[model samples]
Every structure is written in C-alpha cells, then in structure tokens.
Target: MKNITKLPPVVACCVVIATVLWLPESASLYAQQSTAAACLTTSRHQLSKSGKQIFDIAQKRLNAYLASTKTNRTNAPDEPVHTIPVVVHILEPEGRSLLTDFQVHEGIAELNKAFRNQLPESDGVDTGIQFQLAVRTPDCSATTGINRVYPNNPNYTLYGVTSAGGPGLPYDQVYPMSYWNNLEYYNIWVVNFMDQGAALAAYPTGAYSPFDGTMITASYFTTKILPHELGHALFLGHTFARAIGGGDLDLIECPQNSNCAEQGDYICDTEPVNQSSNYICFSNANPPNPCNNNAPYGTVLKNYMGYNTFGCQTQFTNDQRTRMRGALESLRTGLINSKGLDPVVTGQTIPQGISATLTATGCSGQIQWYDAPADGNHLGSGNSLTTPVLYESTTYYASCLRADCPSDARVAGLVTVGPGLPVHLVRFGAQVTEPNTVTLNWATSFETMHDYFDVESARDAKTFGKAGRVSAPFRVTSGISEYRFADTPEPPADIIYYRLKQVDTDGSYSYSKMVSVRMQEMQKITIGPNPAGNSISIAGVSRNWDIEVIDARGMIVQRLKNRFQIDSERLPAGLYVIRVNMENGHTVARKIIKSQ
Candidate 1:
C-alpha cells in the first residue's frame, strides 16, 4: 500500500536584490506587479485639473498652421533642422550621488542618436530636431554642460518638490530657485530618485514658464526615456492616453479612417492604442496584449509615445514628427528663436595625475590625452597613455569624443612611480557555493594607507550588519592582491547581500558596490527505523519523482510513483535497498532493514 497526496501548483521562484525583483517563471505576475503605476498617469491631470486647457489651445494653433500650409504663400521646402540647447542638473543627497561622467555623456549621446535615427537598435524616423548641451551658463560663463547639486536635505526627491497632494514643497518655490530661463534653454533635472515612472515632462503651454522641463530618475535616464520625455516637451501626448471622465480609451477617441488627427494621440499616421495601467510590452517572442479586436490594425507598440518597455520601443511615426515640428514652428517658437548657444563638454575631471603608465576605461569615444582638463594643451591621443619618469607628480586628463561630439572626460588615477600606489580596487563579486554558503571575492591593484576589509550582509539591503571581517596584508610596490570570504549563516535568506568596506589606518573609510547572491533550496531525504519491527516510514519525499524498494540481492520488491509513504509489513524480515530517482537527473538511495 502507498500513501500519496496531490501536489499543489508551484508558485514559481523569485530573487530579490536591492529592492528589484526578478521573476523568470512568472511573466504575468511580474508584468502586473512591476509595471509602474505612475507611467499611465498623464501629466495633464497630475499637474493641474485644467491641464487640458493648454493642450486644447495648442491643438487649435496646430490646426490653424495646417490650414495656412495649403495656401500659395508657403515657405521654402528646405529648412535647417532646429536645435534645442539642454542643461542637466543632477540633484542628489550629500555624499550619495555617484553618477559618473561617462553615464551622463552616454545619456545625452543616446538622446541625440535617437532623434537623428542614428541608433542601431531602432527603426527610427528622424524627427528633424536635435539637442545640444548648453555651452554658456545664465551669466554667459563657459561650462562643461553638467551641474551637480547636493541637497543637504535627505528627503529631497523630484516628486517631493511638487505639492501635488504629496509630502513636499511646492513647485513655484523650488523651480524659481534652480531653473534656467525658460526662453533660452531646455532644462533636465536628474534626481537621485523619482516617485513616478522613469521620468515626467511638462507639455507646451504656449507661454514661457520656469517649470518648463522634465525631471527623471538618474537610474532610468536611458536612451528611450530621454526621447520619450522630450516628446512630451514638444507637446506630444501618449498614444494610449487617458484623461478625466473620458472612460477607457476615450481621452482620444478610437481612430475612424481619415479622422486620425481628431482621434487618438492627434496624429494621423500613428495607429490608435489603449494600454491599461499595468500593460507591459516586453521584447519576448510573445508580446503582451497581442493583436486582437481591441487593436484590429495592431498596436504601434514600438512608438516612443506608447507605454512599452525600453526594449520594445523603436521609433516615432511621421505624423509625430509633423506634430513636433508644428509645435516648434507655431506655439513653441520662442525656443527656436533663442540665441547665444554653446556646446557642452561632459565628464569633466580634475585629476591628481602623476608620471606613470595610465589606462582609461569605460569610454565610448576617441581618447584624447590632455595636459589640463580644459583649454590648455592636448597630448598624444589613444586608449591609454604613459608618461616618462618624473621627479615630481604631474596631472593629466583624458577626453572621450564620439565623432565631433564630446562624450566624456576624466582624470586618470594618480600614478606614483617609486613608493607604491594607493589601494586601487579592480572589482568585487559574490557567488553561491555548496552547503548554502556565499563566497565573496575582490581584488586590488595595490594598497597604501589601507587597514582591513569589513564584510557586510543584509536581508533587505537597507539594514546591513557585519557578517565577517578580514585584515589587509602588507603591500608591495606594483603588486596585485586578491581576497575571499565565505559566509555560512544558518538557513540563509532567499537573497543575500554583500559589500566591502575598505577602511584606512587613519579611520577614514570607503565602500565598494553592493553585490547580491541567491540561494536555492536543495533536495534532501530522511528515513526512520532502519531496523524496524514491522514497518518503516519515509520522510522528505517529493511527489514529482519515483521511488523503488529492492531486496538486499538487488531483486526488485516494490515500486511506486508520486508516493510519499509505503507499507513494509508484507515484506519478509530482511535487509532492503530504497532508491529514489528524479526526472531532473538526480538519484538518491538508502539501505533499510525490515523486522518482524
């Protein structure tokens, strides 16, 4: 006789790291839970109840402009593409803003490429608009085009700046203090955090205002996001827009033949789409919300204005291009007519350079070695530069340029010739090993003023406590060192976090990037009463596998499938072998004795 119970449905496995959850087997659940709620909320409603009033006025202006285009008094067919000067303000908590120059440059470069249809991943239609970093500041002083602002207030977030029924200061109080002249430059605020989706942008109000820009999370300031917000800045609404009391998909009506401009998105070329708040179009073999009656013509999910993930979106339609151009020519002409523009050079660095072999990494442009960070003199250019032996330490900088556009620049780490180099960490990573142990590994090029490594762990990356510690060994000049620490906590959590605290002898300390490791449940079996009187019991058995009982001489006595308990009372009092085999190529065996 065998005892068995039906197995319940597996909920699937998940791993969480630094508040980000990865669900490989639960696509629907992931899509439902992870898709941002704020992405679907239109700024028209978030900013003000009368936000649509400005939009209506802009639409009328566009209609008037289209009507005038039919006359014989049209301008020349060829017109120089207009460029908008941009300024990026990075707001972060004190000692927490770790955004590198390369990251900022990459963000701006991606924006330009997307607009120019130069990005290889998109079937982009050129919008005939361009963005360049502002070369001059408000006072006409030269700038590198990037500004870093450290707000001493720890609760500073982009969303907190607006008192839109939230816990923060009002926009009028914050904008005037930090914003540039709305008539001259397009300002982009990259804060350390955002409560909304990846970012938010204001629509064109046909008037110059201080709150005329976009605010985005520094983490999600990617190629797709920048263009999407820029689309909003040009008065382009989302294709699947939802407004007040219009019902679902009624903010802009469903397209009917030639009335596309009057319907969804107000664009004649882009097909109408209505994605719900939780909809996500991931770039998998099967896309979410496949073509159906709701979208008989199929959704233009690749449009920047759609609520698709970064991977799924690729282009903007011709009508969107026309609309953006119309917004620029008519209602938003002030920006186009503004003068005194300058180029922005990002990734500016002030290095304490010395005479030694130096290598520059993480750059996507041509490398130019400079004696000074700016406007001094240029040295030989390459991916790496080496200096001759020197009696004293000297400074050097590197500039990364893609084509004619400046990408990023940084000072090489100080190169000490004779004594030794400071503790230069190369990389840090973590992995899971046997017996549910997590091993952390880190390496450094050299060490000076270094004390020890403090290993830290946290269940929820927030409350980190010390797990272990290791003292740094004495260092030698031009030598590399590696260290490892294995954490064997009892019954570790599903996700484990680790970080290295590099403390100096002088009590000053710095931290390495946080690394996470995932622990999976391994199978095990337990049996009781090896020398039983009349019966035996089996424990820790899984129903998804098969189990067999055999006599001592290897003769099969009994077999069971999807069974957890078995009766040994009928078997003769002798030694027997119990074997378990799993479908996933795992086998376990145990010896048992039956007694009468």
Candidate 2:
C-alpha cells in the first residue's frame, strides 16, 4: 500500500466538522460534556466515575512503584535509564496487503526518535530525553520484543478490540488477550483504525481492556500512529477533558472542546487547554503551564506527550519522563530490558555505500530490510533480495521474514554495506500519459543488486494486472536512477494507475507507490458564432442553472438570470465557475466556457 499523507489542516478541519454533524445525538452529547465524576458517556469509551476510580487505583499502584524505586536503589542504575521494546502487528487483507518493510522501519525510527528526542529538526520540538532502543537477545528470545503477526480472518475480533475493517474487507477481532503471550513487550496492533473523520486514537500507556489489547489506528502505512499510540501505551492521556461544575480544567473527554482552562489532562504541567487546539511554538507570550495554573494559561504545544501536530510535536516533558520511567520500571520491565534485541540494531552507524548482495530463497513470507548502526532503519522487504541506500551516514538496514500461517514459516535476513555506494530502490513512481505508453521512474539511494524494473499499470490502483516491463540500468553512477517503458498495446482511454516493480536476481520483488493518470477528451462548451455576433447564445450546460459572468477578481460582471444570450462582442474570453445557488441551500457549480 502507498504511504498516506496527512490532509491539509483546512481540509482536516472540514472533515472533522462533517464527521461531528453525522454522529448520533447521544454520541455528540457525550463528546460535549465533561463530568468530574467518571460517568459513562455514549461517545467516550471510558466508564463514568467508576472507571475513573479504577484508573485512580492503577495510578496509585504506579505511584507506589515509583516511590519504592526512590527509596531502594536496587535496580536503579547510576544514571537515569529509559528503554522500551515495541512490537508491531500489521493486520491486512488476505492477499498480503501489509506495508513495505521500509515503512515499518520508518515507523520504528519515528517512535524511538520521538521518545529519545532524536527526531529530524523538521519535526520541530526538542525534548531533553534520550531514549535508547533495546538490544535483541540471543536464543531468539520471544518476550515482549517486536513481533508482527497476521490472522486468517479478514475481519477478526478480540473481545473489546475490533478491527475497524477497511472497505471490501471483513473486520478482524482478537479475543482473549492471553492468545498473545509476549505480555512483557509493548504490543501495538496497526490496522485500519478510523472514526468519522479518520482521526487517530490510542489508549494511554498502561490502559487496556481485559479482552482487547492496545490497538492504534495506522494513519497511512507509516509509524506516526505508533508513536502517538505508544505515548498512550506509555500512559499519556488526551490533552483535553470535559468540564463539570465550576472546575478550571477539562478532563479526558472525546469531541474536544475549544476551552483551555477547564479541561485538565491530569498532567499538571500541560496547560489546561481545550480540545481542537493546534500546536503553537513555545514563547514568552505563551509560556508553559508548569502546574496547569489558572492565572498562567500558556501551553506546551511542542511536547510530544501532548496532542499536537504530528510534524510540530517533538518533545516529552520532564514529568512524562518521570512517568514513563516509572511505568517502564514497573509494568514494562521485560519490554524495556528484553534480551532478544541486538545492540547493533539500536546504535548509530556510519552508512556505507551499497556493497552487499543478500539473497533469499523459498521465502514464501514477507521479507523486511533495515539500515543498521542507523537506528534500525528499514530499507526494503519482499520475497527477493534488494539493496536500498540512505542519504545520511547514520542509516542502518534490517529485514524480517513474514508468511502465511499453516504454511512453513519464512526465514528473513539483515545485512549492512559501507558508504559511497549507490542508493537502493525503496519506492517507485510512475505516471500514465497515453493509451499504449506509460512513463516510469523509481527512487533509491543505493544500487548493488538491482536487476531490473517492471512497469505495471492497472484500471484500479489496488491491483496491477501487469501491463509492461522495463530493465533498470545496470550501473548507476549517481545516487539516484530513473527509467521508462512503453507498452505495446496502449491502455484504453480511461483512468490508468501505474507502479514500478523492482526485482532482485534472487527473485524478491518490491513495489513503489502507485501513480494515477487519466486520458480523456476535454469537453468543450461552445458559445456563439450565431446571429451575426450581435448576441451570443450559451450551449452545452451540464446541469440546469443560471449563469453569471464574473471578472478575474470575482466581482460580478454581468448577470444572466433569465436570458442565455449575452452581448459578448464587447466581452473578452475568460474562465469562471458558473455557480447556481439552488433554493435548497445547495449550489451546483461548474466551469463556464466562453468565446472571445
């Protein structure tokens, strides 16, 4: 599947509003009100006062764990330590609809970076915490280490956890959390998670239902959701709450409110801001609310622990550091100190240019490759062996083998090469221009074993029936390479999507993001050459509507209310949206065709 990009902020806002409008009345009310005493509301999944009490009990237990650590230095090292083992379970359609190996590694890198304050400067926030990836242990230990599993049923259910199944697929559910034995590792299920507006949601760390484990909605084929959910898996709660009585803060409530003072996310430091707020950089004008104090209502929008923009959110608070440490010390010990992770996987490495040509055979499962010494970065994954290079020297490559159950398990491998090598193909790009020909291009940092490239086009992006094939240049002088192919029989004049399929000598095949292109005759609307040009008649109306002529700046030029004929000899040719405001408060808008 292609990586999903975030919708524009304006578009996202509209989606959110539209979603709310379609929600059930009960759900809407539940999202609006906040109660001091936990009260089960329709929209919120948490129990009312009873649920709050249970959460309080858990909090006390966690607090006690922290207190014990403070008093006894038994397991405490000389320096503050933070480690977490994360497992990603990708649930997809029956025909192996999982994400690429690089996408998975990208997700992991994002998670560790956010936790360790090592994210790219582009992410914006700079938390002071340093998180280190746990080393893989010998004996192929199977604790709470990272594990990816696929189920048979398209739509499976496990108690409270239900897969929101995508279109044309059945929902998958997991029953009895006991089915999963790696309780010690943080279990994160990435699947089709979406609500009305496709907004992402995750349970706070340590929060879990008896029947269902922690499930996070995968926004695209990326790891943004994982880090966000990991935060919840680490015990962070929503930044906004509902207000009850005369309280100054909002508690954890769904449908976030705009009020900042009344909703307390339980974190004393996070400003008591309302829901639906955007991430604003920290400034003297907007200082951090150390205690959620009413007089000082500034916000910490840059904090990763808060609900901020994925790009803008970069840091975790000191309080979050303390809490996460405490949680790791108590409940997540096995996950934090797992023996299966290799230290080489977590540490930084000087990226070497493409060098090695690793091959896989009889590997009926999914294969994943990652860049080593580069923080477990993913390169590519498939049945075949391929090399992918990174621009930065701090990139490492690792790969995992995945397969269908009831069949023999697949074996995966990981290898690293030296710097200055050609970059490998991680993704492909293509655009279909003509019926019989397609334009193809691929993206890769390093190229060592890249045998050839195949150009595939299809009527539907979901499935490519294979239209044409092209051979990739054997020797790539530079870090990047591009190729093209023309199919013998031109595709029909219709919408066609194209993708590049990169193959290795070992027969493993990786795919690139699909590009959509359409070939159609532009419908032309002719206006006048009639009546000696005294007055021109408009023709070719797609729908019934009155037309108005507007200038380039949208100022009304002429209104054609009742007459379709206009004196156009004095008017110049231009473009405009012939808008028809219907009596039903709906508008039928179309582009207008005009003649000079």
Candidate 3:
C-alpha cells in the first residue's frame, strides 16, 4: 500500500479545519474528550470511476438494441433464446487448487437459476419467470467453458489484480489485464481479490468480454458473486445510490413502504434498506418503514443482489428482469437465440436407465453402444437412446461416434457418483497476544478425500493475499478438522480480515465465511517529555510490553525492546503507530506523536 502524501502546509491546515467543522457536535465533542479519535474517509472517486465508464458503454449498447427491436410487451420475452458464451479464467499461484469441474458446474447452475427465475428456492418472493438452458450445438459446443492458468507469481494475492510495479510484481509480471482481448466472450477472471470495503464490483454495467472491455475481480467468483457481477454485466447499479449524489447507502434491506418517493435505491420497485452490519439470518431486523411520506418501505435483504447472507439472498425483481433483457438485446447479441449448434433428444433405452438425450446430427448410419449392459445388443438410428438402468451412486461415461468424422467421437460430461458436500468456514478462538501475531484456527465440515485449505488475509477487505495453506485431512464420511496459522508483521492501524479456502483434489474449491479482527488501542501509557532533546522515559500503568517507534507517515523509526527508557539523540519528530505485542496471541496498537 502506498502512503498518501500530505498536502501543502496551508492546504493541510485548511483540510484539518474543514474536517473539524464538518464533524457533528456529538462527534466533535467525542474527539475532544475521548482518548482516541476516528476519522471518516471516502473512496467514491477511487473505486467507482472505472465502473461508471464501463456501465455507460453497456447502457448505450442496450438502448441501441432496444431501439432496433421495438418489441412491444410489458415483460421480458419468455425463455427468449439467449446463450451467453462465457470463459472462466482460474488465476492462482497453485493453479491446482483453483475451482474444480463440480464447483464450476455448481456456479453455472446458480447462474442459470438466477438468470431465469427457475431457482427452486426463492426468497419468499414470486417471480413468474424461467430461464432455460439452450440446447447444445451439433458441434457439441458449449457457450461457457473454464480455463486454468498459473501466473506462479507470489505477488498475486487471493484477491484483486496486482499492479505492474510492486513487491508482488514478479508473480503477475505479464498481468491478465494486458492480455484480455476477446470482447465476444464473457471473460471472468477468478483470482485472489483484495481491497477493504467491497466484495465485488464491475464497471459500466459490470460486463466484461474478450474485446471492448473487461471487469476482473476475485470476489465475484464465489458465493453469488457471479450473479451480482452479472447484474452489472446486464446494466444494474447498486440499488441504493443517492439520487442527487452518485453513491449507494442502503437499498437492499429495510422495511417496505409505498411512499412513491424516489429515495431508496432510486428504483421504485426495490424496498429501502439499512447498512449490513452482520452476516447471519435473512429476516431483516428492521421492517419496511414509510419514506418521503409514501407507503411503508420493506426490507429486500433477501434479494440476490443485496448484501445479505448467501444462504438468504435468492430473488430478482421484475424491474431487474427488464434491465437484464435490455442489456442482452443491446450489448450481448451473442447470447440471444442460439440453437441448432447441438441437437437434443428425449427417449428411453432398456439398460442406460433414462439415457441423456443425445444431440448428434447426420452422417451416422446408426448409434451403437459398446459394453453397455442392456444396450450392448441394441442399435439405434436416432442420435440418442434412453436406458432403464438407474445408477445414481455410480460414475458413468459414454461417447458418440459418427461416420462423417472418423476420429471424432465425443465424450460425455463427467457425472459424479453421489451428492457433493457443502463447504463452509469454521473459526476457533478469537484472542490476540504479543509480537504482533494472532493465532488463527479453523475447521471444515462435510469433507471429501481431495479437499484442502488455504488461509488468506487482507489490509483492505477489497484486496487479499495468501498467507498460508493447510492440507485437509481426508474424511471417510462427512466430518470436520481443526487447523491454525499465524499472521505476522501486524499492522498498527486499520482492521484486518481472514478467511479460508477449501480446495478439492480435482481442483474444485469453495470459500468459507470471513472473520475480522481489530487491533486494540493503547492510550493510557505516556512516554514523552514534550519536544524531548535527548532522552524520554515511558511511564504509566505498568504492563510488560515491547514498543516500536514509527514516524508520522507510518514508518518505523526505532524499536525499544521491552525497555521503558530510550535515547532519542538520532531521531527527528513525527507521528507513528506504537505497537505492543502481548504475551497472548493478540496485539494492541496506538498512535504516538513525537517532536524534537
């Protein structure tokens, strides 16, 4: 992280004064009376500019598509033929631990469920819609595919893209941002993401492609991150941005009201919401309340796009449907009405037990099954056949051969033997000690033979880097295991987040819930003789602790190893974080002002 240079002396003074004046009476009084002060900062400009531009371009494309179609209907066309071609890029240092085929399939399933209102489980809302999977092409080609690439760069964290020049530069020397070129394919890069405030973000409508533009981030790869980013891909912004100022405050979870006031989310359909403080159950703590003198506003925390617990979020509004369709028409023409690429059949054969409807085309005299128990002696003229055998707990494989293409037999997709287990993050004790190190412990339930774990940390919640890894002990059945790791070089100020990654042997992976720790503030100890020329004595309530002196700009100036007295002959005056590593696993941090 780069330090923000201070403004000119006069400018700095003005900013300080302005900041003080802008503080409310309560905050101002607290700052004066309280031992420590909290400051409020804004990143509206830093993070959103790029997103805004991408959205504008997507919006224009959508508008153009709508104008050309001129279709007159109230709702999005039913099961309208749209097949978006997507390419999933797995970016990781140890590429083998990236998402697996099953995980990717699950993610795709979730994507389809959200896109079409076919999710069996809805968040108590009725969205009369359905999104059907487009039939495979005669080429047996799929619109979506996953690709894995290893940067082998240590600098690439588990989150966010790395810049060209930095400590972590060598790992991603040839960064992905530079190689992105295909605009037609929805390019989703699943790498380690970091930053502090947001889980995911997409620019200009959040859509990314091989050509034109791209939106890359790791947060969107897990949970419902893909759907949320896809929403941006289709032209949706944060539901709760202020009408006058372009920023979202609360629009996803609050009480519902019929005020007709355009305050919440700016979209009339979505209910007003409060900020998310915890990730637990879905039912909103605060119900809908009236706003702008309109009807009461209700909470939409359960909406898939809202910042609710993954387990709770599940639906999309009708308005959102319109927005998505509009985007498809305008910016994603490749997604709509793609058929005949693969043929689908529906039939039953004696042994295969409900055979997968085959999609092969001309050039074959008849389809034959080799080594197929019941179908071994049977032959078919059509592309597919259904068997009566039910093998739910067993793996199955099949291939299709054609006379036109001699060496062109297609292998069927891999089918799992049994239901897969749901991966979750489990945390242990939450205590800190000295040397600025925190012992992190965790466990996983519902394990598989190939599963493993990775520990990650972040300075800002938006960006994260791998800290360590723990191979998951295999489980004969569903079970759990406890593991621990330590975070070194603890930061003096700011909160830090830690999380777990469960990886399967086949490379599929899932993320556990995130945990955060705030360093305790030490304000009681005083160790200065104002503008001390040579020596200073650390005197206050006694506590055996080590102290490290840093400059005003967060640079370490000197370290006093367990000593209460220090000679300051070689030091200049400044500000720094006085860090105290406790004997336990926790740490305490305080700001120190030094003058010479």
Candidate 4:
C-alpha cells in the first residue's frame, strides 16, 4: 500500500498509526491499513471528482421504476432466487497452492450466507442475490469456479483495474486468458502484489471492461473482503465517498431530503460523512464529518462498504439493496442472462428397478449429486451418482466440482428411475443377518394412501412367496415412511431373494423389483488387491455407502460417497483403514496395505 505522503493533496484524511502487521515497502496507498480493513476506497472512479456517476444514474432509474408499478423489473425475476456466478482466479508461482480448495469453497459459502443474510454475524438486509461458483467457463468447459495460473515469470504482479494495461501489462494479458465470461460470471482475481495490500473493485459501467472485476491480495482473502469489493462491482460507493469543502452541507448532504440521494454515496439511507482514517469505526455520536458542526451521523459503522477495521463489517442497508438490485436490472443487466453459472447436465431415463447415472459432460473433475437444487448434504460424488433401486421416477441436482468449487447454483438435472409408481420409493435394500437370515429395509415418500408392505421371498430371482408383512406408519403427508421386515428362513440357506409387496389403502398394490442376497456376502467389506497399486476396488458395498480412507496416523486421506472404487494412486505407501458407512446407520471397516 502507498504511504501517507503519496496521497493526493485534495484526498486528505488523517492517517491512523494502528497497524501491527508489516506492509510491503511498495504497497498501494490503498493498502496502508492493517489486514482488518479492505481497500474498499480504491476504485478507479472512487477518487474522481465525478466518481459518484454510477449512483447518480442509479437513483433516477430507481425513482422512475418505483413510480411505474409494483411489479419487478422486466429484466429480473423477483420471486425465484437469483444466482450470480463467481470464478476465483488464483495466480501464483509454481509449486505453491496459495489458495487451497477448502479456503476458496469456504469463502464462497460464506459469501452466499452474507448475501442471503443467513450468517450468524449478519445483521444487515439480505440482498436477495446469491453468488455461486461457476460450473462452466466462458468456453463452456466444466470448472471448480476456482482457477489457478502460474506465469512463466515468478515475479509477476497485477495492479488494480486502474493499472491493468500499464507498466509490464501483466493484468491485460492475464485477465483475458483467465477471466470467465464477465457477464455470466463474476471474476475475482486473487494474487500477491508488490504494491497492493487489500483489494479494489470495478463498477458496473466497466462490466465489459477488459479488466472488469475485483482484485485482492491473497493476505486479505477473508469472508467479508470479496463481498465489500463486490458491493462496488454492483455500483455502491463508499459510505464516505463524498465530502464537503467545509461549508454548511448538513441537511443537503445527509438523511434530510431527496437531494441527499444525489449526495453522499448517492444513497440517502447511509449518513453523509467526511472521510476518516482507515481505522476508527465511528460510533456516529461523533460524526466522521467535520464540516457540518459535528452532526451525529447515526449509522452502524460495520457496513460492508465502509473502510472500518476488518471482521467488523456485517450488513448492507435497505437502500444499498435497492441500488444493487436496480443495477442488476439496468446498468448490469448482462449479468442476469449469463449462462456461466448453470450447472446443467445430461439426464437419463431408466426402466423400472434400475438406477440412473447422470453425466455432466466436459468436466475434468468430480461430479456431485444433491437431493435438492440448494442447501442440503451432498448425496454422493464421482460418476455423477448411484441411487438405490428406484420404484418411481425421481429427480436430483448434479454439478461438476473441481477443487471443491461446485457449480454452486441450484440447477436441477432430472434422473428418471422407473417407469412410474404411485408412491415414491426413496430407498430399498437388504442386509444379511445371522447366517442365512435377512433383514429387508424400504422407505417411501409422499405416500398418503399407502397401507402396508408384504415382504416376499423366493429361492431364485423369479417366482416369489410371502415371507411377512410390515404395517405402514401413519401416512405422513409430507415425509418419508420407512418399513423393515426380518425373514428367518427355516434352516440355514445359501442365498435368499426378497422384494416388497406394497399394498395401498385403496386395495391397489405394486410389486417392487426382486433383490437377491447371498449369505454373509453383502455384510463383508473388501478392499483390494490387498497390497494395492494404482487404484483399489471397494467391493460388497451398495449404492448408499459413504467411504473414508484414513492413514495409519488416523488422518483422513480420502473421502467420497457411493462409489465402487477410489483412485488410490496418490495415497502414500502406508497402512490405511477403509471405513464404510451405510445409510441405515450401519458401519464397517477393513484394513488396506498399500505397496511402494
């Protein structure tokens, strides 16, 4: 960050000697503060005498729209949740993964929680905007939303948009090669710069600018940093963006009239104030403004658009939401139609009794399955999926994940399981019991008319006979009803077959696909070839299993759900335990010895 002496004479603000960390000798003037504050004050147009133009135009558009009707703007759909795709580009030297996959994923997750106002620390308005990691790049290839680049020159650096094409011209070349579709995806460049400490953002007017996006130093890649810069990307100026040249600019500059909307920050809700040091969050009792007789600027200093100490920002004002969403409809309308965020896939239609395997083409990464399009534990990964025997058609959500960055949107991919059944059989399985004994498990959802399940058994796959009956739980209108039946055949047999006879309350009945079982076969978990080489085949587990491979030190080396095999080539030569967990809450483990 730049030193105090380098600041322009007209851009005078007191300097706070409050930093405890070391700032690079060549950092930007924006990076003078400690890590707790983002360089939110460093937009290209922010220091311009005419920097507030984005806000000025936004206000007139807002008034004109509010005057028109109660309807949502024609460009944006108000009811359905909107998703803004984000792509993180981490540029660093070779041999270093500066931003780990987990860090990027966690940051994106927190970014959404902040925008949705769901974070525990969030006391601000939910912007009604959801930021998702992009599943596809500009050229339509799958990605983890996190992209890494290694320049031939180890000492490469990128300045903010203000310096994109200047000096060495690294930003100009790097951005065009690294950025996803700007309109479809929000690009955030993460790097370590010789002269930058925190971050800077581009306004919507530059949505198509060659360097259109936010750039932040790696040290400040915290949860709130991106959100604050993105607030500028959506056209929000700093809460202290405007100040008077020392005159009675009271009611005219603050929350007093419509003129205030045309004044400070161009949002009347944010109290107008003169610029203060990067530190000290005003209590509003002592206004940051000095020209208006120290008027009380009633506000929460923790606004995301403020330069207060980091970890202190928690909210966006109501007018801030309007300005942002309004920009989405007007100035930044291109983002609304960007297809970069779509996590679409090729679905499948299978006959009754089989499972469907969906594929997200062009993904050179793991594919994840979700029960819903948003907010839920992932059902499994790799192969896109492995569902239990489906008696009824079912739909699921799928996204390609590279580096833990999922196509983080709630895009649905249909997977038809069966021809069609009245009641949805969400789960169906059989586990071996004592010797030849077997326990059957089945679950159904949305069964308001279901009656009971008649357990049927047979010596072979075809021609079944009744073994027992399990009464249905009181028909739950909106939940799943599970049933279990244990069959103990006379004498210990080698193998047994089982299926469900689902009889409805109305006397209609359907027969589930026959599931055959062998004695002690399904109970055993196997990992081989014992002293394995490249990959290990995990045999004997069904589709509902979750696996965790732990090294001898008890550290989890690999984890994934519902897969028959795992790539063990990368695992260091050592002894490891493969623990298999079933959906019925049953768990078993087996030891594997990897050879050098």
lDDT tens per residue, model 3, 125-154: 223222222223324454335666777665
| Candidate lDDT (C-alpha), each | 0.59, 0.43, 0.45, 0.61
Compared with the true structure, model 3 gives a TM-score of 0.42
Q: Of 1 and 2, which scores higher on TM-score?
A: 1
Which residue pairs in candidate 1 collide? 135-342
CA lDDT of 238 in candidate 4? 68
Single out the weakest 10-residue window by summed lDDT for candidate 1.
10-19
- Which parts of model 1 have CA positions greater than 4 angstroms off? 1-49, 70-79, 157-173, 242-258, 277-299, 340-596
| Per-residue C-alpha lDDT of model 1 across residues 1-596, encoded as one tens digit per residue | 01111111110010000011111113553344232222322332433334445556667988788666522211111223667777788776555663676888888889888876678776856776888677657675667668777656644643344334445433334444467876677888776543333465666666766667777767667647678788877867776654333423333333233456675567766655555522456344443332124443333767777655656567877668777877777766656634325221222112122345555542334567777767777777776677765545566777555553434444544444333233567788765434366667789876776788999987645468998999996544357788989888666675566788887777767666676654542223655477865556666654477778889886888998867677887999888867665543234556777877
Per-residue C-alpha lDDT of model 2 across residues 123-179, encoded as one tens digit per residue: 322222233322232234334333445555534322212224333222223323222
- Tens-place lDDT per residue, model 4, 154-246, is 446434222333343244455665766565678888876624335645666523554567767676676466777778777677676544432
Which stretch of 10 consecutive residues in model 4 shows the poorest summed lDDT? 13-22
RMSD of each: 24.1, 24.8, 29.0, 24.9
Order of all candidates by TM-score, from best down to worst?
Answer: 4, 1, 3, 2
Which candidate's TM-score is highest?
Answer: 4
Return model 2's CA RMSD, one decimal: 24.8
Which residue runs does candidate 2 get wrong by more than 4 Å? 1-50, 70-80, 122-172, 175-179, 193-213, 220-223, 245-263, 279-299, 339-596
